[model samples]
Target: MNGKEALTPREFLRIADFFATNGYRLGPKIGEGTYSKVRIAERSNNGEFLAVKIIDKRIAKKSYVTKFLPRELEIAVLVKHPNVICTYEILHQGELVYIIMDYAERGDLLQLIQTCGGVSEKEAKRMFKEMAEAVKYLHNLGIAHRDLKCENILIMRDKRIALSDFGFSRLYLDQQHGDVTSKTYCGSRAYASPELLRGAPYDPRTNDVWSLGVILFIMICGKMPFDDRNLKLMLKKQMSEGVTVPETVKTQVSSECVRLVYQILDPNTDSRPGVVDILQSDWLN
Candidate 1:
């Protein structure tokens, strides 16, 4: 059934039969959105693990129902990369939209950061290298993950980074393949770009770079680069005062890595380095 449309009684019955034949036993909820919840699930027959994202269309906002949700489904199904989570199936039953994805047993990057305080320079380079590659691939395909915070970066059991969540993601190209600007005001304020904070029509590609910089900063510094409790103050700090590394971890992170963070977190979007630039930087190698 098309996720965009409402399902009929006959269609619902058919899908129910399908579920009965090859279904997943739902487990505890691991993640959530405004109208969606991500829960761990296991295949009934083989016990294969999966993350099931269930979206309740009945209670979704009008903008999300018509705009972001559709784009998320389209892009999520379209992308396939080792450094990104894999979508196994999408089922639209009645008012529910179920998206089955690969399960990351080690949880998200945010969890790791909480447990380890801050990652070593060498370890951050390795993990962030994979994340940059994933973002580079998406950008090459004209997609911009408007939300690029640490929580969206997942960790597999082997410690590989799997970039997840595309609810705010969309192609940043026009019909003629030209650049396009967005005014969606999506993404967490802690990781939001300067232009986004100003509520201007901003280029999502550059906006994504800013969020990536914040993620990298937190990975190495074990703290947010700028305090976002006050949006106005946060924007001011983002543009002028520069990053405030914690006193405890000041000497631990390399100057080279710090330089890249500043370059990526540039207030002038045009001056900010893209993901490819980060991948080619000296710190990563």
Candidate 2:
């Protein structure tokens, strides 16, 4: 059933009890957001771990559950790749919804960056390669992860990447149309494309590429290429200067990597490379 479907509190508890009986045991809270909190869970029989994201029904309704939760659930179930987070099942009650998903023990990329300053070139390349693969998989399926960013990328203990959070993602085209454009201005400002900031109907795939560029820059430099502190100046810089690899980065990062970032961050959306093209770039190789 779609997330919009309503259920009684008894139904919710019965489903939760059924999961508990099967093997699931809820553990400590692991993550939190404006609308939800994630908790660690374990399968008592096999010791397998899972992340359970619980969203309050009140908050979901206020935030337009029909617009996001259903869509996210749909995409989460449709996609299955090594580089993307896996959604196992969803359970709901009268007051909350629980989304069962794969748990990454090493936390997310944002936490990694904050803890390590910036990643070494070797580490950055490894992570970026996986991320590009994940994006390519989504694009090939006609989906656009509109809210891609560092915070949405989780890291396994082995350091492999798992792209998460599909709240702002959706299919961008139909069989009848080759490419469809969107006018929605969602996602973090620092990682937004120029067309999104300019308030235009833009290609979501290209928009995703621009955000990927921003993420790569952050991974290598430990800071955003565009800051939202000065909105007007940032927009002007985004429009004219595009991305600037600092001298420090030039000295430490490979030239090919820096060049790839520039190409992906091109102010003109049409100039940005698609996920497949980016995956085949020399830098990634």
Candidate 3:
């Protein structure tokens, strides 16, 4: 099925019925969002587990989902990288939209960080490398994930990372320009780039790099580098003072890691390293 195409309610039901007939079993709910609920499901034929995200069409139509869903589905289906969550199928039934995806048994990075306080530098380096690889793959495909945060990074049972949640992603290319910039200011406040916080037009790719820096910081420090509750103060700090690695973290984390964080989180987007540079950094190597 071409996920990029719009589907009618009747067509959606037909697709859902096909999947049901093909032995997809929806199980207990595993997570929930404003207009969607995620459940564990089993593919009867192979007994493989998957996550089924069911979205309420009624609510989705009134939210950002109405505009982002198509692109989200398209990118999910097209991007196939080891570090990216796999979108197996998309179905619809009446007022509900279903997205079948690979199940990450170990939950997300946020949950792990909250449970264990934080990860060791060695572990954080491995996870960050995987994330950088995934981001490089997306950028190569002319795509940019605007919302790259710890909560959106899933940990697989094998200890690898899978980047998920493409709801705010966008293509950076246009037919005429080949590459373009974005002005949308949508993402977690704490992870947002300085330009985004300032309501200025920004390059989505660099914006993602900033978020990755924030995620890395959280992974090692167990706290946000920027304060989301106080937007004005956070913006001022980000633009003028830049991110500060607490003396405690500085003592624990490697100097290379600290240098990378500062480089990635630079207030001037132009100074921030691209995903490729990050992937090739000595710390990641």
How many Å off is the CA of 128 in candidate 2? 0.2
- Model 3 spans > 4 angstroms off: 1-19, 61-65
lDDT of 1 by residue, 1-285 (tens): 223334466754564465556576766667787788777878888988899887888888899989999999999998999999989889887778889999999999899999998788888998988998999889888899999998999998788999999999998888786758988899999999999999999988888888889998899888898888999998888778877666566578777887888798889887788787888898887
- TM-score between candidate 2 and the true structure: 0.91
The collision pairs in model 3 are none
Q: Write the per-residue lDDT of candidate 2 for residues 1-285, one digit (tens) a residue.
A: 223434366755675676697568877678876677787888778999999887776755555487877888889889999999999988766667788899999999999999999999999999999999999999989899999999999998777899998888988886686658987888888888888888888888899999999999999999999878877788899888777889989999889999999999888866778888898899987
Each candidate structure's TM-score, on Cα atoms with residue i matched to residue i, is: 0.90, 0.91, 0.91
Q: Model 3 over residues 1-285: C-alpha lDDT tens digits? A: 222324476865665566678688767667776567777889989899999887776656554666777788788889899999999988766666788998999999999999999999999998999999999999999999998988899988898899998888988788797657887888788899988888987889889999999999999899999888889999999988988899999999899999999899998876789998998898988
Q: Quote the RMSD, in angstroms, for model 1.
A: 4.5
Candidate 2 stretches greater than 4 Å from native? 1-19, 61-63, 176-179
lDDT of all predictions, in order shown?
Answer: 0.85, 0.85, 0.85
Clashing pairs in 2: none
Off by over 4 Å in 1: 1-18
